[model samples]
Structure formats: C-alpha cells, structure tokens
Target: MARRRRKSRGRKLILAVAALCLAAVYPLQEQLTDGGGDSRGAGNAAAEDVSAAASDVFRDGSTLEVHFLDVGQGDATLIRCGEAAMLIDAGNNSWGDDVRDYLEYQSIGDLDYVIGTHPDADHIGGLDVVMEAFDCGTVIMPDYEKDTQTYTDVTDVMEEKGYELTLPQVGMVYELGEAAFTIVAPNGEYGDNANDYSVGILLEHGENRFLLTGDAEEDSEADMLDNGIDLSADVLKAAHHGSRTANTEAFLERVNPEYVVISCGEGNSYGHPHAEVLNRLREMGIKVFRTDEEGTVVATSDGAGITFNVPPSESWQAGEPKG
Candidate 1:
C-alpha cells in the first residue's frame, strides 16, 4: 500500500508539471498570432528575417504610390511599392487606429520600413501602437537623443519588438524594385531642436522624383543646400506644415516642385499654412494641396510621370481640372 501511494503522488507531480508547461506555451502561441509573438516567426516565411524582408520588398522592378495620410493635427505618410509598404511619421497617438485601418483597407499585410522623422510626439507618438500591430521589417529615424517620455516609450517598444534601428544619413539609398529612395538631410551631427534633426528623403523613379521634408527648418534646409545634394523634385512635401520658418524662397527655387502637399490640422493653434508661405507657393505657380481641406492626397506613378486623385467631387465634372 505505501509503495502504491508513493507511485500515485509521483504521477500527480508529473501531470502538474506538464500542465504548467502547456499553459505557458498556449499564451506564447496566442501572442504570436495576435501581433505579440517573436517578430522573427510571425510573417511569411520569406519575411522571417529583417534583412530578407527589406530585400524581398525592394527587389528590382516595382511600381510606387505615395499616400499623404490625413492624420489631423499631425503627419503620417505611407508609401506602397508592389508587395512592400513603408510608413513615415505616424501622427499623434490618437491616429494609430486610423493608420492601421487605412493600411488594412489598402490590403497591406507587411511593413518594410517605419520612419520616425524626429522625436516629436506628433511625429513618433503613433509609432508604438503601429509597432505593436504590425511585423515591421526595420525602423529608421534621425539620431536624436531626447529625454521625453514619448521618446522613451517609442524606443522601449522598438527594442521590445526586436526592430533594428537605423540612423538616416545622406547618400544612403533604400531600394524597392525600380524605385530608389535617398536620404537627403540630417546629414551630420544631430541638431539642438528635434525639428532641425528631421530626416529628409528623396524618392526617385525614372524621371520622377519626390522630396519629403519632415518639418525641417531653415538651418537644416540651408545645410542640405550647402552639401550640394540634389534638392529638385517633381513633388515636394512642404516643410514644417507650411510654416513661415520653412519653405525658404531659395530652397523652394532649388526644389522647383510642380506640386506641393501640406499636412496640417484644421483650426490648428500654430496657424499652419501661414499666409506668407501660401503666397510663396502661389507666386511660383505650383499646385498646392492641403490635408486640412482635401482630406487625403494620393500620388501614383507608373515609372514615368505621376497622377493625382482627390475624393469624388460632385461640383466638378470628370476630366475637369481641379482648382
């Protein structure tokens, strides 16, 4: 009888251990499926590795579409090229779901790059939520050292998600098929103001080039010009949401973009798209679009020129030029 009792106790102990192990694994498996698992094993087997993800998405010969997402009071831009996608600066934290929904609506299942132009909350705030929701390939940002809580939270989530952080540098190129993106600003030392440290990128496809300037001020813009980087583009994102401090006349002349997109919120405190900046763009005869008025702006290219589409308009007839 004593021997039998001891045997039964040992069996019970083994069963309990097995139960605990199974419980642990169940949660891990669940986490992986719900965007909480090891970043290495969640995506298509081909995207299992970060480097592989970049190479697969950027393989030569891809079409590109640039979407200027409407994240009110902040900035969020999405670039889609073939099977790959990249996001630049998620708006304020409140717009995370909007960003995710927009991605889902467009059938984007994987993200190749997520760039936080700077540490400002309006720029990097929504990134944490995005990191938690997607299996990101890699994250790139300016080399800014700030002590803000938002910055800390963004870094913590990136580290936790096992994302490789890359610092933007001029001459560095990111390729996706036939499309090529070159970093244009934040060329040297990190700046004193976070905005000055904004990461500027230029995307080129055939004769078409698009310049994205992330709230960079006069100082940074001047530095980019002094460095002799090609500032010309067919499309330009107006710096600092069209603030007077940016879009300097000389810088605008160098870019000479045919179209300019400004991202700003309605009734914003800073009075973005200042009168002076608007006049400058008007004087240059550049077509200007604003998120505050147009909702979202999308630019698509087919290896040659680009086309613009606005939300359906009843007042205007088909083929009619937009005001």
Candidate 2:
C-alpha cells in the first residue's frame, strides 16, 4: 500500500511538470504562425530571431534632422540621424563650394549615404566635390547613365574614391540611426529619359515621413501609385522643381502632403514653381516653401512632429486654384 501511494504521487508530479512546459510553449507557437492558422516547429527559431533583431532598432529618444540646402535651381538635401548622415544630390557644379560649406557648417564628418537621384547635371554636379571633401561609404544612383560631362564628373569621382556605385532598386530599405528610408521608384526600366528614371526615397522617422523625388515626372509617379507604394508623406520635395510636367492632380491628391518644398533658383530661366502647380497646392490648402524664396529650408523632427526653419507665415500663397 505504501509503494502504490508513492507511485501515485510521482505520477502527479510528472503531470504538473508537463502542464507547465505546455503552457510556456503555447504562446510561442501562436506567435510563430505562418498565417494559415498553422505554426510549424521549424519556423519558431526564425521568428524569434527576427523579433530579437527588430528589438534593437527604434529605441526611444531619437531625433532626425533634414536640411534642404538652397543650391540654386538644384536639389541638395542633407539628412542626419545620430552619427549617420545621408546627402541626396549636391546641386549644380557652380554650387559645389556652397554645398560643401553647408555640410561643413552642419559639422558633418562623413557621409554614410550619397544619393545622386539621377545623372542630371543639376542634381549631381557638385557630388564630385563633396566626395573629394569628405569620406563617403556608399553612393547610390539610377541605372541609366548619360554621356554628358556632369555624369562623367560624378563617375570619375566614384572611380577615383574607389566607391562602388549602387543602382537603387524598388523595395530596398536602408537604415540611418533609428530612422529608415525605402526606395519606392525606378522599380523597373524607364526607357531613355533620365528624369523618368529618377530615384525616389521615402524617409521614415517614427510616425513622420518625407518623400524626396529627383525630377521624377508623371510616368514614374503613375507607376509608383499603381504599384501601391505609400505615396503619403508629411512633407514632399516637389518633383522637377514644381514643373507642370509632374505633380499631376491625381498624384497630389494621393500624396496629400501638408507641405511642399520646391528647389529652384530665383528668376530661373526655366520658370519653375509653375502657376499650375502653385494653384493646385493652394486649392489643397497645402503650405509651400521654395529654396529660391526662402534660402535653405531646415526641418527637424523628434520622430513625432516636424519644425521648419521658416515659419508658416513665410510660406507661399498662390491665392486661389483656377477653375
């Protein structure tokens, strides 16, 4: 009778241990499901690994700073998050010194990412100078190349600096400190036009977003919209300096940006910031900032909201939208 009682107690202990083990595994199994209400054992390891890796990112108390340098009829934006810095374009050749000075003033020690957007002279003309002035980790550009001197100058610098040029592809994500940016345009071939092949970067800082498109026209914009890429942004860098060829009504409606930044020279021969685009922005009640009108536009974000160098009262007002 004593032996039988001992056996019963042992059985109860084993059952309790089994119950605890099962309880611990249940939550993990549910989290590792592969979506069809099925959780396979092999996927558990991968799921846990991914979760651990993501945990290291998006830590609390991170700030992002963006500087839209007034490179005069060209685009040059410097984004800095912690120790990482990214430069999108460097303006025209004539503006090389200015862009370099601005970077220096910002105390940018090195450039982690340098994006040319396209091979256009206005976009990348000063990049060679920038590369010469500072150490660059990666250089990104469109797949298409032009035979123009501007393109040659940029490539020459890349070769001289022993930097491998990366042609941006759609859906590629890059990290800048706690913030991240994704390439959302030039998904595929864009034929002959360099502007149409422009690279678009969607920068994300916590809940805030900024879209920068280097001279991308309607065709590229349409493709991005059709691909279901998130075109919505808090601030948008106007395409082609706010030309009529781009920024169609449909594109504007989809992006629905609260503010637009246009990079163009004052009294530029191209007549940028066209009346059509201005009127559309007005109708949407969106605020507009122009490099030509406001010098350099600097916006800082604390991962939740953004504050610009210039006040809202300084923003452009086109009065009314044409019927």
> Model 1, 136-190: lDDT tens per residue?
9868898886888778877887888788889887878987556779989886664
RMSD of each candidate relative to the true structure: 16.5, 22.3
Tens digit of lDDT per residue, candidate 2, span 69-165?
Answer: 7666789999988888999998887666667755664457999999999988889988888887889997899889899987887787778779998
lDDT scores in order: 0.70, 0.73
Give the range where candidate 2 is weakest over 10 consecutive residues by summed lDDT.
1-10
Give the lDDT of residue 115 in candidate 1. 87
TM-score against truth, every candidate: 0.76, 0.78
* Clashing residue pairs, backbone N/CA/C < 3 A, model 1: 58-176, 58-177, 59-177, 60-177, 61-177, 61-178
